[model samples]
Target chain A: MTTTDPSSTTPPPDRRPGGRTARTRAKVLDAVIAQLGEHGFDGLTTDTVAARAGVHRTTVYRRWGDVGGLLADVLDAAGDDDWIPPDTGSLEGDLCGLNEEIQTALTAQPPVMMALIASSFRSEPAADAQQRLWEDRYTRCGIIIDRAVKRGELPPGTNARQLLVTATAPVYHQLVLLRTPVDPELPSRAARTAALAASAGAFTEG
Target chain B: MTTTDPSSTTPPPDRRPGGRTARTRAKVLDAVIAQLGEHGFDGLTTDTVAARAGVHRTTVYRRWGDVGGLLADVLDAAGDDDWIPPDTGSLEGDLCGLNEEIQTALTAQPPVMMALIASSFRSEPAADAQQRLWEDRYTRCGIIIDRAVKRGELPPGTNARQLLVTATAPVYHQLVLLRTPVDPELPSRAARTAALAASAGAFTEG
Candidate 1:
């Protein structure tokens, strides 16, 4: 019997149709998310993650190095998911959609979000990753404000990031900081409040 | 040499005038705050705290039992501090004052605040303490909104909690979530936005 070479078992990075390298990355990342959801940041360990992913500990060590590296990959993969901000014509509708997205994330996977936020406070690498995550989210969500401005729903020069942050902050405060249940009406209320503020030009930077 | 009883060396709990009990408690609490500020929640431990406080390990063990109990006391003491919310005549002034207070806390002791927030996620007792802290802050801050309504600055029946949460969420998002440098203008801007929303009746529960 001819022995198969280990090198032949792995595909090049560009290979598209379910290559071994791609499969390994996917499995590792999926395990990261699952671990974050189940145990939070403090409970995450490379060995545990490797065991969960059914990968060798040395592979995890060589690939991710540590928890920070693993966390960055997890956040990067999450950021790469296909998500388009809503274009509902009206500023209120756009903001409501945005709020709904935040609410859904916080409600459905609180542990993962909490772990990410907590990581921002603990390590430099995690902070960099979290900052990048927020920057990416802000850039994507800014489209709502841009569309609203083009539609004459908001005045020109409105700070899109500020508006979105204002609209979303209370939802996070309720769910994370206050540890309170986010009522169904809270997101709509936040969106309406933000819309009112935006129309009044409260977000305009001088 | 006359022998003294070890039990008699300790003063009763209620005895004041800088008694040993009070001094020990003060040192322990101060050490807790210092540990939280320096090492964050993850690095804190009873043995370390007791050593830092120069108190007996048994004393810490018997008194606090765990980190959660120590955290509860720390929060309780912080809440008990003499701080009256600003009652500026207008909603803008009151909110601005409120914002400044939060900004000061976040800026002056970011690690302490971060540790407290992180602790809330890790333990049920800490979560309870955090919830109570927010509730107390909200009630105290509500007086500002109440006065605003009395002065006809906002619509009657406006949700005080909603307005305060809206006004402060951005500050927290800046300092904690986004990890952005909180510009001096951010708090006032947030106040204006919340004020605009309150005037538009966005905070009214319908």
Candidate 2:
């Protein structure tokens, strides 16, 4: 019998980079986020990233191995202060608050965040990084819906992750893909839709 | 004091050295789209695009002008198929059909398409091209929705453009930014949502 598996890993390409100074690495990581915001993934390059971070060229290569690795690390670091969905004990209030929080954050350099999400298509490191990035946000969202489910505010079989992704994804596309300015009122409306979707069993596993 | 527009024409960055060659342009465009599908926009280059197209290094630049221009042309040509929503006389059926058509066209090469969209941020030409690409699709969509409005299938106040964009944008993101696999069924769900949203006066103008 022939074995069939499309899943395969490719070896990482070595950049032969001289390696960055420790201080430069930290700065570069921050700069990666900012650059992602500024230039977007397509526009970002090692030269630009290095310049922005004030790091030596080789250091970015030796440390990150490539652009994908660098972005993955940045995503890992961006993990902070992004999660933490509120729980007002009511699913509606919790989601509304979370959407508001996201909307405010989106207002600042939205292109960068969008680019990061968009960048996940490149390969190994990017795919892994995006997965990690979404995992954190999804987990936080899951907790809120789980609470709702437990309290019977939502259906007993709600798939919180689906509800969360479906709800927020529209907001992301409206701003990022379409390049349309977000309506100020839409975030709360999204949350309301999310809450209703939850109550209406749109997320119910059954 | 001085009254003037920014410029009669945008920069000619899209122009390459020498002059444009139709054959070279078409080949280079193919290469760009092919590479974009495989390697994504973040890390690809004119050299690679040239190599893939079997053109001289100078030809890539001389013909397409630059990577951005190459990408813009490729995307424009891809969407030149001129898809229009069928006049099935039912808004729900029309949207669902269009949704499925887009899903079929997109999910197979979603990564490459997304990479192009993300890269558009860095190049004004690419951005302009993207807008043009969407306009064609949207125009056809408008025709369908507008007909529905005339038939009373949709509310008179419907924001057809927003309704159309919302219905379609998520499908793009599912395969691109969210990295979710797009199932054939999913498109119909999205279309149904849009149809229902429209019927509920979600598209109505205030």
Candidate 3:
């Protein structure tokens, strides 16, 4: 994470991906995600994470500070992955594809995504990182709306973020909030609903 | 708060609303909600709740047992309220009204609902209690779809739960998950989108 303090005279040196420091960081962050998946936020401890990553406990404390720091770094690492929204010719197809990806992640054994979401509420740093990650995702998915508009499937002024939120909210609500049993048809059905609403200008910016 | 142990032959007496036991239960539960809104789950303790309720700490521990137990009872208490869905003549109006109610609750000072939601992730008892509360609310809200169907606004065999989830998910997603600045227009817009989709048969039973 970049230091936010403007008073710092000397900048921290950048560690290349192959460097020992970078490798250690990766190991620790990977362990954090795995640990969070296995044990929800309450069970996550720096000592356990350090043990899992084969790092010294003192080093873990000196580096990450606490569980919140570990969680924030894990989320920041996730944002580093080069992920782009799907392009399936039609907006509904793309949305369905995106929802399927979310479903898979949220419904994974010992679901890491759901665990992280739950942890964010307890950790301000993690919550901030997640917000940034969500914004990045929203921006990337804006292309779906742009393409739909060009294809004459949606209004030119349709709010991309709103439409995308409408399209995807049902999946998150079902899996994370309600903890309901998975419905095989929800992904396509929700996608179709959003697409229909968008085509009817329900998501058009006022 | 009903005991699940079948081995216990003695049945607990039902305490009337005006009874001392009932009053103490109400006070303690109210304190839990207040403390949650003020200090969040991490700040909540049996001592603090007991002090706030003017009840003894030992009594609280003996009755509610723990934080999870207190949270569970609070949710169970909320379910006792007689809340019915809006009876607006138009489906859009009713949905919009319901959305407004959700928006108000989610956006309240200190945001008790958001605190409870976050706390549930950390407590199994609270999660189970919340599930029951959600199911009850969903069942009660089913009347919205029935009224809409009878009014010819929505098609027959429309899945009430699916439609309601689609309509309300965006508000929770934006407010709780993203923690975004309030968009005053979102509640009505989301309701409008869902209403349009339902009218188009996007939420029809498969």
Candidate 4:
């Protein structure tokens, strides 16, 4: 028996069948992403989303309650379907992989990201969703730092959240604030700089 | 002759006496800020701003042209009125001062900052203002890093923009993205971390 590569063998999460309920969820969420990209948070309405999704308006209202609920579900679905943290035997490798994943996501769907960011600032539900997403990502990325610490690659008591945030903040700043191009070298540079800082205990709480 | 402290002697920019033209400009800009804070960019309209400012609608239309123009003026006024980068004799002190200034501005008027950020994403004029604002700050803070290099404190050719961005990005991430409380110690920690990274050539372009 031979082990198969998960990437090669596994069906895309949305493509895998779970019957009618899953199909409806996939359709609704896809419509939500499309609408968000087209109209941003301000212009998005449940009626529009329901119409676009070809689902009943009452079903959208009853299920999601409001724009915020719908947004939260969209965010949850966005995070749920992809990109588990990789364990690549070294902190640098893991962090680089994580940064690459981020770069890919941001590049692949910039408009959706822009909408999500705008929503986070203006809408309470969206803000909550954004917070939960960051917190969840931070918790998952903690394993990379923990592995590094165990291998004596980083100092003990390293602040994983700080490290991960520091590594990724520049990328977000570039994408969202500065509107600068995120060059190919950026992810590795960010990861390397963060790894260096962590090794020197810059992220350790005093 | 004894020298008086500049801060004590200098009238605040907004309070300084000027003619009717200056006063009118100030009034309009103040209204822009208020409208931005209250309504954000999407909701802000030049007519509403003119109404709020108690100026003639035609005057606003002639002066600012549109909502984006008003927002650009607001951002310019916001950046122009306050927070000159400090020359605190050392890189760490200067960086800390810079971060504290940012924290102060963000805390002092969160709604205005949020409005500016939102506008930057949606409007071209606002995005230009945002870009100019960051470029100006980065250039001003470059003096800090240059001084450090001259004093043999940091390595030569260190990228000032990178250092300042890295030091500040986490704070912005907390405020804008994470919606987390920026603790009192965060400024100093960010400064220290950037300083450490700068020393290690993390910010030096290859």
Leading candidate by TM-score: 3
Poorest stretch of ten by lDDT in candidate 3 chain B: B10-19
* Best prediction by lDDT: 3
Using Cα atoms, each model's DockQ against the true complex is 0.67, 0.19, 0.74, 0.56
Docking class of 3: medium
On TM-score, who's better, 3 or 4? 3
lDDT of 4 by residue, B112-132 (tens): 776687778778898899888
Instruction: Output the number of the DockQ-best candidate.
Output: 3
| Pairs of residues at least 3 apart in sequence or in different chains that clash in candidate 1 | none
Residue-pair clashes, model 4: 0
Q: Which candidate would rank higher by DockQ, 1 or 4?
A: 1
- Candidate 1: residue B92 Cα off by (Å): 0.7
TM-scores for all predictions? 0.90, 0.72, 0.91, 0.87
Report the lDDT tens digits of candidate 2 across residue range A77-148: 777555577878788788777767766666665555656665765556877877777777878678888788
Ranking by DockQ: 3, 1, 4, 2
Q: What residue runs in model 3 are displaced by over 4 Å at the alpha carbon? A: A1-14, B1-14
TM-score of 4: 0.87
Worst 10 residues of 3 chain A by lDDT: A10-19
Q: Output the better candidate (1/4) by TM-score.
A: 1
Q: On residues A1-206, what C-alpha lDDT tens digit does candidate 3 reach at each position?
A: 34334576664434534556788899999899889999888779999999999999998899999999999999998998889999999999999999999899889887899999988888999999989999999899999999999999988999999999999999988988898999888899889999999999998767
Q: Which digits, one per residue and each the tens of the lDDT, describe model 3 over residues B38-92?
A: 9999889999999999999999999999999999999998999989999989889
Number of the candidate with higher lDDT, 2 or 3: 3
